[model samples]
Target: MGQRTVIPFGPQHPVLPEPVHLDLIIEDEKVIEAIPQLGFVHRGLEKLVQKKDYTAFVAVTERICGICSFGHSLGYSQTIEVLMSIEVPRRAEFLRVIWHELSRVHSHLLWLGLLADGFGYENLFMQCWRLRERVLDIFEATTGGRVILSACNVGGVNQDIFDEDLRGIVRVLDGMRGEFGELSKTFFRDRSVQNRLGGVGYLSKEEAQDLCIVGPFARASGVEEDIRSYGYGGYSALASFEPITSKRGDGYARCEVRAREVLQSMDIIAELVDKIPDTPLMTSVKGAPGADSIAVSRLEQPRGECFYYAKGNGTKYLERFRIRTPTSQNIAGMTKTLQGCDLADVPLNVLTIDPCISCTER
Candidate 1:
């Protein structure tokens, strides 16, 4: 019989930048069971929506998670758009798709860097972040903020892109593509990274579907579910977009899924730059008509699918607002996937789930 032991993995850890806490029950060096604790960063952002007008509520939504700020704001705006029956211009929708994919690329790059750092591949970590900086530069150039763009508004977006700016973005992405390819090969083909991540903490397709997993986590497990396919944003007009999927449902598979998606995002952005139509960027959003109107909206964020529900009264302020982030829905599956994995594989396993505590707690 093996000796049993319990180890606390986080609340505060140098390797994990996020504040998620996990307790691992181990038999020797293998994990037997895993438990997760959340709510360490809760600030009740959902409840604050009732105090602000529908337009002002965008600020609160953007703060749901720093990494997913754009997606959060986009989701909130879409919900309000639905509630108010606003017809967003085609150009604005395409712009939304551009920024959305750009945000996705930046986010996946950040995760890849963190994953590399977890495995002690400091150079690889730096390389991934170096490429990610170009995406941030594009964000700052267009939206005025690197991390939290806060460019989404209720009727449409708050910013516009010019022809010169679009050309600059395309050039930067072209440069990033070459660098991304090299770094991806180094990470995926390296024996050390493969040994640490490949086939580690696997979840079967059935388990993933049964648990209602979202985003890359589910896509890696062979779930062909993507919110973009619903044509909520400008995705309906994306001529060459495809959802990235893998059947392995393991840590390495998740990494591959995100890496491939990053390339796809670049492709989407390039396509948009070539075809961006000239139109008005903003539509004025007036007050809500009644106090009981409600609408639900969902978006395919980089992490996963984020859902927002907004209810308004016959005033400037909303009556209630609710958000269900991808991380919150995937925590159960993440813990289940961690069981029976090697202790050394803990960081990769947790990261494969892309646990965003800020989104989960909020």
Candidate 2:
């Protein structure tokens, strides 16, 4: 029997962008167990709902994670809308979904680039980020901020994208489709990429359900669970929605699902702008939420299912606000996947779940 050793993986590492620290217990070259350490970057932002009024906290939620900025803001606003019974206009709802899906596209692209980098595919990494830049350009042109777009509010959006600009966004995504297709081919068919990732970290469908995994991570494990499938909000307006799933349950499957999701999100954005109605962007918000009123909302973030909760005290600020990010939910599944894997494959296996420590610990 090989001697076991304990190796601390990160709060800082070259491979992972987030400050996720893991104590990997390994025997020889195989990992036997992994213990995660979190809360290093906890900022106590959730408690700020007390200081920041209900409406003002939209910006605060937007800052939860740069990649999922629009999703966080949208989820928080949707929660407040339910609490206050705010009927967002149809046009606003469509716009919300458009921006939210765009966030998903860019986020997946960012993850794809990181995955490529993790595999030492430098050129592929640059190409992925270059395409991601186009999505950011769309955000910059519309919301004026590439990353932390402060566009969402409780009732609706702060900015209304005109039909002309919406068409422009579609055109841009359309143009990127061909290039993205080529990238997908490389990710799927490249011998090196396949050899590096294929069958590396396996999570069976039953295991995924047992762990209650969310988003593409679960989808990769063949669990057909997507918040969008329920058709909430503007998603109801979509022609059809089904989560992109792969039954392989490996690192390759994870990459494949995310790569495919970028394409799916682009199509969703196109549908949204096509059906977007011309109406008022923002609804007038009046009166505070009912005393002790609580509302919860769920969103399919880039990582997985994000949960938002808000409790109102019939005052300007919410009595309490909480967000359960997907990464936190998937952390257990991540550790479970680490057992019996090669020590060297740890980073790529961890990246497959796409951890966002900022959102998870906030």
Top-lDDT structure, candidate number? 2
Q: Give the TM-score of each candidate.
A: 0.97, 0.99
| Model 1 regions lying over 4 Å from their true place | none
Q: Report the number of clashing residue pairs per model.
A: 4, 0
Model 1, residue pairs in steric clash: 290-313, 290-314, 291-313, 291-314
What C-alpha lDDT does candidate 1 achieve relative to the native structure?
0.87
Lowest lDDT 10-residue stretch of candidate 2? 270-279
Please provide, for model 2 over 120-206, each residue's C-alpha lDDT reduced to its tens digit, 9 standing for 90 to 100.
999999999999999999999998999999988888889988899999999999999999999999998999999999998899999
lDDT of 1 by residue, 1-362 (tens): 69999999898988778788888999999999998877789899787866776788789889888998888888988998888899898789988999999989999999999989987899999999988898898999898999889888978888888888888888999988888999989878899999888888799999998999999999999998888877777887777556789999888899999999999888888888888889898887766736688899989999888888878787887788888889988998988888888898888788788888898898
The per-model lDDT (C-alpha) reads: 0.87, 0.92
Sliding window of 10 residues with minimal summed lDDT for model 1? 284-293
